[model samples]
Target: MSASLSVGARDLPRTAARRVADGLALAAAPTFALMAILVGAGGSDVGQMLCAGEQGLQIGGMTVMYMLMSVFHLTPWLRLIQSGKREAA
Candidate 1:
């Protein structure tokens, strides 16, 4: 009916936003995984150049930065998973 149609119309934007977030989350997992691998494999030269100006952090600041960024980007995935769990329950 018109009310259901109206409800669907209102949900359009929210659905689109969820799609976007899901897409980003999909990309983020692989991206952070690759970055973690590269960093763990001693690929922080680029990161060091960008962050430490050739001096570099004695404690691997670049790796820490990437770790923080990866965690930050994990929000969407976490929310998606929680929502899925709730729906399942």
Candidate 2:
């Protein structure tokens, strides 16, 4: 039925959006975990590298990666919020 087809058509984007959010969550989780570990456990190493005039590129890279993933993961949630559509129960 066209009505049913229309229903499904409308749902497709939301399904895709949810899937995208889920995927981003997976990627963001490990990124933040690694970031916490690097910052917390590797603090001394990072500090030493900085004090020694080294660029500490690894730490900087991790920070950048973490921020990027967090932003990506947050995007779906922001869109969902802005759309004013309540998630299906």
TM-score on alpha carbons, each prediction: 0.53, 0.44
TM-score of 2: 0.44
- The residue-by-residue lDDT of candidate 1 on 35-82, one tens digit each, is 765675565567766677664333366666777778878877788789
lDDT of each: 0.74, 0.67
User: Model 2 scores what on Cα lDDT?
Assistant: 0.67
Which regions of candidate 2 fall more than 4 Å away from where they truly are?
41-89
Q: After TM-score superposition, what is the CA distance of residue 6 in candidate 2 from its true location, in Å?
A: 0.6
Cα shift from native, residue 23, model 1 (Å): 0.4
Q: Residue 8 deviation, candidate 2, in Å? A: 0.9
